[model samples]
Target: MLIRSSTPEALRQNNSLSVLSALRRQGALAHTDLCAQTGLASATVSAITAILERDGVIERLEQKPAGGRGRPRVLFQPKRDCGYLAAVRISSDQVQYSLVDYAGRLIDRFEEPRLGGDGATQAFGQSFLAALARLAERSRLARDQVLAISISSKGIVDPGAARLVWSPVFGGAALDFSALLGAVWPARVLLANESLLVAQAIAAQREGQGHIPAIAALSLGHSIGLGLARRDRHGEWEVSAPNFGHMQHVAGGSLCRCGSQGCVEAYAGFYAVLRTAFQVPPQTIPAKFVPIAEIDKIAAQARAGHRMAIYAFRQAGQSLGAGLARMMSLFGSMPVAVTGPGLRFFGLMQEGLLEAFAETHEGRLNGVPLILPMTGEDELVFEGHVTRALAEMDVMLATGQGGGAP
Candidate 1:
C-alpha cells in the first residue's frame, strides 16, 4: 500500500531503471530492443544509454554484422569493471564471503569459521571487518571499488538498514550492520534473511510466466525459514521473511531455541527431529547445532522402516504443513518452493505433509493445487543476493547517485 511519486526526474529514473532491469534480465540488447522492452521512446533510450555509458555503468558493444542491407546494430551491457559487490553469507558454523562483478560474475570467495562466546558480537564484527579487508586485498581492488556489500543471515533483519534485528546466535543482542560498515566503508550495505534471497531468486527466474499472484518458500535445517514473494496489483514485487519458524503453532507444547513454546521450528527444525527420534525430553533446550550427517542417518533409518525415525519425520511434516496452511489462510494458497538441507527426507514426510495440508480450512476451501518444488538453497541464496544488490545499484545509477571513479 505504498504510493510513489511520478515527477519528471522520477519518470526519467523509472525509465532508466526499466532499461537496466531489461538488460539484467535479457542480457545485452540493441537500442531498439531496449525501447521496445522498456516502453521508452527511442530518443529517451538513446539519452539514458548515452549517460550510462558516459558514467561507465554500461558499455556499447561493437556493431554486429548486418544480415543483408541496413546499418549494423550496436548492443549494450552492464560494464563489469565499473563496480563490484561483496557478499557475506553468515551461518551458524561458518561465514562465506564472495566478490562479484557488476555483471554478477563471482570473482573470489572464501569461508571462515564463525566465532561464538560471551562477546560473540564484538568478535564477529572484528572478523567481518578483517574478512572484507582480505577480500579486497585478494581481489586487488581498492575498498572504494566495491560499490555495495550485501549480507544475509538466518534471523530477523531490518529491511532498510542492513541490521540484524534478532538472531538465534545473538538472542536479544541486535547488530546494526549499516552503522557498523558506514563508519569506514563507503559502499552501500544491504541485509536480508538467507531464505528471503532464495525466494527472490525463484521469483526473478519465474518472472512473466503466468498469473502467479504469489509464491511461498520454506527452508528447513537446524532452524526453519520462510519467504514470500507476491506480485501486487501494480505488478511490483513485494517480498518478506516473516519470522515464520518462530510463529506459535501449539501453546505450551514444546520448547524452542528462541525460548518459546511450540514454535513451528520446535517440531520442524532438524534438532527437533533429533530430539523426537532420540526420545529426548521436550523441555530440554534444543542443541544449537545439528550436523547434516546426523539427519542423513535418520533419513536412512526412516527409509529402512525405523518406526521412531519415521514418526519423527512425519511429526515435522505435520508441523510444517500446519504452519503453511495457516499462512495460506492469511495470504491465500499459492505454489510453495521447498529448499534447504532438510529436503533430503521429503519422501518420508510427503504423506503427513499432504494429509495435514488437506485438513486445514484454507486448503479445503480454496482447493488450490499445491506444488512443492525442490531447489538448491545455497545457489538460490547467492543468486538472490546478486539480483537484489544489482537492482539497487541500478536505481542508484538511474538516480545519478553513482558517478564514475577518477
Candidate 2:
C-alpha cells in the first residue's frame, strides 16, 4: 500500500475539493446540501463556495420555491466558462476531438481520419497536433483557458505523463502524448485506455445510488478490452484498463497482432471470428478491420445453421468466457458490463459464452458473474472524459494552478 503525508496547503485544497465534488455529484447543490454531501461544516462550505465564486470557478443560482411558499433556495454550480477542456478519443480509423466547458458540457466536436489506421508504421503526431490546434482555434479558446486535454486510445498508456506506451497498430513504437502537446499548449495532459474510460463512466453514473459494486467493463471489437472500476478507501472511483486481449489463452495456438501466439484476442477478436467462419488457417494474418455488414451476414448464416459460422462465434465466446473466469478468480467475482461494436453479435455468442464460463473452476464454485450487454460505447467514453477531466480541473483551481488566476 502507498501512503503520503498531508500538509496544511494540501488540507486546505482538499476542503475546497470536497465542496466542488459535492456540487459536481449532486448538481447545483445548496450550502446545506454541500455540507450534508461532503460532511463539511456549514462554515467551511460557505468559505469554499465564496472563494470559488470570487475566483469565477462557480456561480450561485437563486431558485424560487414552489407556489412562492418561502424564500428562494440558493444553489451553486461550476461556471460554464471557468475554463475549457479538450477530449480526444482515438480509434483504429479516426480521431475524435471534443471541446468541453468547465461544467462538463460538450461545446463542439468533430472527427478526422487517422493516417495509417491499423498499419501505424509512421508518425501521426503532426496531423494529431494540427487537429488539436485547429480545435482550440475553432473554439476561440486561449492557451490558459484550456485547463486540460484528456485523450483516450485503444492501447497501453502511461497514466501520469499520458504516453501511449504500446499499441497493437504501432507494435513496439510508443507515442509521447504529453511532450507532443507540452510545447504548443499549456494545458495539463491526461491519457487513459479506451475501456478504462468506459469503466469510469459506469462508475460515475452509479454514484449516489447506494453502494457502487466493483465491476468490470469488457469491450469486444476488433480487439478485446477489459477495464475494472472499484471504490478506493476514500470512496473514489479507481479504474484500470489491463491488457486483457493479449493475455495468453492457449499455448502456441493462434497468432495475434502483437506477434504473440494463443492470446485471447487471437481467438475473440473480430478478425479471429471472421477467420474461423471462413476456415482460415491459424497462421494467416488477421485483417485490420472487418466490416459490420460482413459480420452481420455471417451472423445471418450462423442463425441459418451454417456450421462453420456457428463454430466461429462459439470459439470467440469460449475464449472470452475462459478469460473472464480467470479474471474473476484473481480479482473476485464482479458484474461484467459488456459493450462495443461487437455487441451486435451477442446473440450468437451468448450460449457458448455462458457454457464455457460455467465450466471454469471459479465459475462452478462461485457461480457465473452477471453479464450485462450495453450499448452507446461512444457516449459512455465522452461521459467518462467529462467526469475525469472536470475533477482534475476542480483540483487545479483549488490548488491555484488553474485559469482566471485561480
Candidate 3:
C-alpha cells in the first residue's frame, strides 16, 4: 500500500473525508479514479483508502480485469455497517424517527401522532425519546453505535448552538433541545429545520452528478417550508435563508395561523386546503378527513371535470406558485423541487401554478429547471438528518477531533 509522511492542508483537513464523500456519491471507485476525481496524489489516495479500510469506514471489492493494464485496479466502497445515526422529523401532524446506517440507508423507522394544540412540545419530547428507544431496540443497535442523533423540526434551527430559534407551528419560542435530550440520551445531538435538511439531503445525494448550480425544495404539508442549496463563492455548499413560507402571496386573501395576512401557508398548507374543502357547505361531509387521502380523491374528481374540486386546487396552486415566483426572483432562478402532501394534487394544480409563476416572475427566469414530486423511498427529512450526522462524523475524523459528546 502507498504511504505518505504528511498530508496536504486540504487533504489533511478533509483527506479521507473527501475520498469517502466522493465514493458515497459515485458508488465504488478505483484508486486511480479517486485521485483524478479528488485531485489527491496517487500515494495519498492509496494511504487514505488503507486507513479507511482499517477503520471499517470502507472496504475493498474485487478488481475488474483491464485488457491493457499491467495489473487489475482495486475498487472500494463505504462499509454499510460502519455505524448508525438516528434521524427524527418533527412536524405539526406527526413525529417520524428512523435508524439509518452510514450510507443513508434506513435500518428501521418509527412514527407517532403529534400533540395537537399549545402543549405539544413537552408531549412531543416525551414521545420522541420513547420512539427513539423503541427504534434502537428494534434495530438491535448498541447505543454507542449511534454516533449522532439529528432532528429536523418545522421551525428554524441554529446548528452552531443546537437550538430551535422559532417555529410558527410549534409555539413561537426558541427551544433548547440539546439540554432537554442531554438529560436523557447518551449520543451527540444535532438539530436543523426540516427545510434546510431536505435541501442538504438532496444535494448530498446529487453531488458529482453534474454541476447543479442551485436547487430549491418546497414542502407542502401542514405548513409550507422551503429549502435552497447553492455553492458559495469559496466553492462550499451552503443552505440559503429559510422562512419562505411566511412570504405574502396576496394583499388580503386569508388569515394565516401565524397571525399573518395572506401568507403562502394560508393558501398552500394542508389545513388551509382542507378548511376550504370543508367550507363547501356539503351537508354530508365527513366529520374527520385525512388531508392526504381526501386530497387525492379531490384531485381525481377534478381530473374528471368536477368544477368545485378543480377551482379549489387551482386557487391553492396559484397562491403557491406566486410564492415560488418571489423566491425565484430573489435567488436569480434555479431548480425548484415541489414535494410533500401537496404534490398529490400536482395534476390538478400544475397549470394554475405555472400560470401564476409566469404572471408574477418579472424576468426571463422561466428557463430554470423545476423538480416536482420528490422521489425517494425513505422520508426525505429523516434521510437528511442521517446524511448530516454521517457528514459531521467524517469531518471530525478527518480533523482528528473526537466525536461530539452526548
Candidate 4:
C-alpha cells in the first residue's frame, strides 16, 4: 500500500526496492544499466546505490575499463555477507536443512531422519531447534546474522500464522512454527507447503520474457501435493498450495489417512497403489507410511506387464487426472509441471492419466499442457526457499523493516 500522495521519502524507498530487485534478478549491473533497467533517473540510481553500499546491503565491484573511450565503470551487486537464510524441508521420511547466503548461494546442508514417537510435534520442534543451533555453530555465524528461516512441509499451512495446520507426519496436530522458533531464534520464521515452494522455484525460473504467466506444480510421492503460482492482474506474483490431494476422487471408495473416503490421495498416493496392487480391501485403513522401495518394486512389476501392478498405477493416474481437470476448471488452463520422486513411474500412469484428462471439460475445451522438465526436487525446493526468503529480505531492507515480525 502507498500513500494517497507520493511523498519524496516513499518514492525513494520504492526506487530503492526497484533497484535491489533489478540487481537480484539480473545479477550485477553498471550504474547506467541500473538506471535503464529500473527506469529511474541517473541521479536517483546514484543516490540509492550510495545508500545501499553504505548500509552494506550492496557492494561495488572493481572498476572495469570502458571498452573504448569512456572512463572506467563500476558494477554493483547484492553483498554476499549481508545476511544469511536457512531452508528446512520437512518430508514424511526425513528433514533436510540448507544454508544460503545473501547472494543466494548454497553454503551447507544436512539431513536427519524424522523420527516419530510420542509427542511428535514436540520432538520435531526440539530437533529443529537443535538443527538451527548446529547450523549456526558449524557455519560460525552469529545468531543475528541469519535473516530468515523458511520452512516447508507437505501439509496444510496457515500462511497467516506461519504454522503447519495439518500434515501426513502428524495428522491433526497443529505446529505454530512462528511461536515455536521465535522462542529460540531471532530471525524471521516462515512456513509454506512443500509443493508451493516448487511452484515458486518454477515461477522464478520462467520469469524471462515470453514465459507463461502462471503454472501448477504437482508433487507426487507417498502423498500428492499441488502448488499454483500466478501473477495477479497487477503483475504481482501470488502462490498457493491447495489441498488438492484430499479433494474427493471417488465417493465412498478407499479410506484415506484423513479419515475420509475416496480422496484423490487415497487413490493416487503410494499406499493406495500398494493396497490396490496387493488386492487389499477398499475399506482397509491405509498404512501410516509406505516405503519408497515398496513403490519402486510395484513400479518394476508394472513395467514387467503385471496386470495388478499396472492396474494399480492406472487407477492412481485416473484419480490424479480427474483432480487436475477439476483444478483447471476453477483456475483456468495453466500448464502443470509434474515433479517429485514419483515421476519415475510416470510412464506407467501416462495412459490412464491422459485418458482421464481428455475426458475432463477443460481438457476437451482447453487442452491442458503437461510439462515434465528434469530437475532435482530437493534443489528446486531449496532454490524456492532462497528466492522467496531473499526477496522478502529485500522488501524488509528497502522498507526499513528488516528483522521485524510480520
Looking at model 4, the pairs that clash are none
TM-score of every prediction relative to native: 0.95, 0.96, 0.81, 0.95
Stretches off by above 4 angstroms in model 2 are 1-5, 117-123
lDDT of 1 at 282: 89
Relative to the unseen true structure, what is the C-alpha lDDT of residue 217 in candidate 3, on a scale of 0 to 100?
82
Poorly placed runs, candidate 1 (over 4 Å): 1-3, 66-71
Report the lDDT tens digits of candidate 2 across residue range 1-406.
1113389777778888878777777779888888898888888888888888999988989999999999999989989998999999988888899999988889999999887645454457888888888898998877778999999988898876788888765667888877888998899999999899999999887775889658899999889999899888877678998889999999998999788899999998889999999999997988877888888888899999999999999999999999999988888888899999999998798888889899999989999889899899999999988898988888888888896533
Alpha carbon lDDT at 179, candidate 4: 89
Query: What's the TM for model 3?
Result: 0.81
Residue-by-residue lDDT tens digits, candidate 1, 2-108? 11568888877787788888898887999889989988899999999988888888898867576655776789999998888999999888899999998899999
Return the lDDT, model 1, position 188.
90
lDDT of each: 0.86, 0.87, 0.71, 0.86
lDDT of 2: 0.87
Residue 132 error, candidate 1, Å:
0.7
Model 3 bad stretches (over 4 Å): 1-11, 54-56, 61-73, 115-118, 184-186, 204-209, 234-236, 277-290, 296-308, 361-371, 375-379, 402-406
Better of 1 and 3 by TM-score: 1
Displacement of residue 346 (Cα, Å) in model 3 is: 2.0
